[model samples]
Each structure stands twice: as structure tokens, then as C-alpha cells.
Target: MASRGVGAALAIAAAGLLAASALGKGWISAGSASVGLMGGEVCRGGKCKTLELPEKDGWRTTGTVAFAAALGAAGLGLVAGIMGLARKRSKVPAVLTLVAALAALGGGIAFILVAPGKGVMEHLAWGAYCGVGGGVFAVVGAILLMRAAGAGPSYAVGMPGTANPAARTLMLAETAKVSGPEAKTMAPGMAMAPQVQAPRPSKGAPAMVPPCPKCHGPLQFAGQFNAWYCPRCQSYLQV
Candidate 1:
């Protein structure tokens, strides 16, 4: 239930992590030689040489992207956290933070997972962990904030998305229906007719009898001729 507090706390933590990751150095380190977002040094026999890469886009470029993305995520997460702590329902902050986090995650993957380096510390780098971790934290925090921002109520009866039983049962008392000549009262949210209907026959009902057209008298059944006989009318009657 304490969604606001929880969401705010998570966002703050994510912001802190991302901020540090974006600014910190030592993305990769082996002994005294260490690498960062821009460049690092290579040492041999107590001597060190500056690493030089192609002028075009390279791993450093990806690292730079990652650094920028991390910073963006941090800023967004901090804002989202502040909004959540204020007990305000705002989806913009959460959504933007999630987007920035995803970008940061993509950058981390590009440099930490895809790009290759000469040394053994290429994949096992502290800066890489920080970037990835911050992204993950931001993503989770954004999700919590989104949840904290309440959505509207679900539908009532006959709705697939309806989740509240109470809503489904609302207005269930008064309903009216009419089928054929008979009027049938029904409860709201209930079917007018049952799944199956039982057959009924009238009791003591005389069939195959008709009144004479002219005399208006009941015609007698004629079993032998398969018709009716009107004694008063004295004519063959069809029943």
C-alpha cells in the first residue's frame, strides 16, 4: 500500500547509482593500466603508453554514450523520486526515466558486452557493472512509480477486463424484460431467459374442435371421416 514511499525511495537510490556510474572512472583495470570512458594507459616493464584508437566512432564512443545515458537516467530518476515522495500521481516522470534507463542499458551492452579489448579485464570491469546496475535500478524504480500513479477503475459486468467483484455486482437488483406476450422481470446483469426451456402443455384442453362459421356452434369430431360434424349447422366442418 505504501507505493508512494517505496517508489520514491527506489527512484532516489537509482539516481544516486546512475550519477556515480556516469562520473566515475576505471571502467577496466589490469594492474596499474586502467581504462575509462575516453581512454586509458597500457603499461609494460614499468613503462606506460597512452592508448590511441581510431578517430572515428569506437569503444570510447560507446563509453561516452553510456556515460551520457547514465547521467540522463540519473537526472530523470531523481525527479521522479521527488514527485513520488510528494504524494502526487505523475506518469511523465516515470515514463521518461524508464526511457533514459533503457538507453543507458543499451549503451552498457554495446560497450561492455559487444566491444572487445586486448586485456583480460575487458568484460570484468567495475564501471560496466555500475552502468548496468544503475540502468536496472532506474527501470525498476520507474515501474514502481507508474504503479503508484493510480489508473481508473475496471469495468462492471460482462467485461473481460473487469477485476472487481463489487463492480460486477453493481445495479443487479432492478431489471425488466418482455418476451412474446408475457412480460418477465429480471435482475440486472442476468440473462432474460434461462439456457434451456421446459415444455408445458395446457390441462383439460380440447383440440380438433372448431366453431361453425355461420352459426357459431362447436363442431363435433367425426372420427370416420377425419373431419368435424356440426349438428346444428348440418354441414361438414374442418377442424
Candidate 2:
């Protein structure tokens, strides 16, 4: 539960940061000109060129691509966060969150690597930092969400799908020991006594043992009480 809460919070934060990065200015060019996922301006002294979505400039094109990708990441991250907050174990949320991080990081880096040429002075700004931070948060949140999900049942070798090797044992190990009489004076060449097999746990015991309902720990069958026992909880379970 705690993991889910923290993960959801991080994912939501990532969504906000990533959205801001996409919409707000993140790069500076030509001294006074700035651009972001949306667009930028190219300025020379007192004159400034406003770049927008339909512009054919190389840098603006890159920003357009990044803008779309960043926006998608933000949307996906928001959905994933909401799903996690609701405590839903759906795998799609984690998967989508990870994909969001990848898309955001890729778009941001692409903008930086292929931003400008022809003597254009361009440097990263707060928007770029926000994208990076959001990507990191998305990754961490996805990991936490995956960790919080429950694991599927396991099967043992040569056993049915419902049968788990750990549950097959009915009771604790209770092998008989040979020590009552002449063990202290036994000859060195004597054969060892045969070990005694422990008794069956229950007459109609099921082959499968389930995970504990409380802690999800492995359970053992106790024949004397005809019930499943959780060693971790140190108590008998009704199932």
C-alpha cells in the first residue's frame, strides 16, 4: 500500500513536470530568443522572429516533434498515476508509465542533439531540466508499481499446476534417532539404523498449499489440526 501511494505520487508529479516542459520555454537562442516544445523566437538586436507550429526552421521542427512526444508522455503518466492511486494491479499502468518515461527522455535528448546549426547559439534551459527530472520520476514510479503487484502461483517439478512442492510436506521433519541403548558402545563396523518416515499430515489432504492470506508467505499443512499453517504468522489458516 505504501509503495502504491509513493509510486502514484511520483507518477503524478512526473506528469505535471513533463507537461510544463513541453509547454514552457526550455531553451535559449540568439541571446534574447527562447524556445521550448511549443516553439521559440530568433532575435537579432531589437528584431525578433516568432516561431510557431507551422514554421519550417530546423530547431522549431525538432521542438514540434518533442512537443508531441512530451505531451503524450505526460498524458500517459497521469493515467498511470491515477491507476496506481486506485490500487489497481493492472500491468498496463506500469507498462504505460515506463513507455512514457522513454518517450519523454528520447524527445528531450533529440531536441538537444539535433537542435540547431549555422552559427545558432542554443543552450538548454529549465524546460529541458524538467523533462529529465520527469523522466527519472516516471521510471522510479513504474518500478515501484511493478514491485507492489502480486506474484502468480508457482508449480513444482512432476506435480500438477495446483501443487506446490513447499505445501506437500504435512508436518515438520521428525526423523527417528538411534540413541537409547548401546549407541555409546556401538562397534565401528556396525550398519546404521534405518530412518523412520514421518506420518502423513491428513487423510484427505490436498496436494496444493496456498500462500498465506495475511503476509503472502508459504503455508504448510498440519495433519494434527487438519489445517494449513503459516510459519511466518505462527497461526493456523482456515483455507
lDDT of 2 by residue, 1-239 (tens): 57778988888898898899888875544467777777767778889787663344465577777777777777877888888888677768778778768877877777776665554333667888888888889888877876665422221222323233344331211101112243333234433222222233445476666776667788787543334567887765432
Candidate 1 lDDT tens digits, 76-96: 999999998985667899999
How much is the lDDT of residue 27 in candidate 2? 54
What candidate 1 gets wrong by more than 4 Å, as runs, is 40-57, 118-123, 152-239
Count: clashes, candidate 2: 1
C-alpha lDDT of residue 81 in model 2: 87
Candidate 1 lDDT score at position 116 = 61
TM-score of each: 0.57, 0.57
**After superposition, candidate 2 runs with Cα above 4 Å error:** 42-49, 52-58, 117-122, 150-239
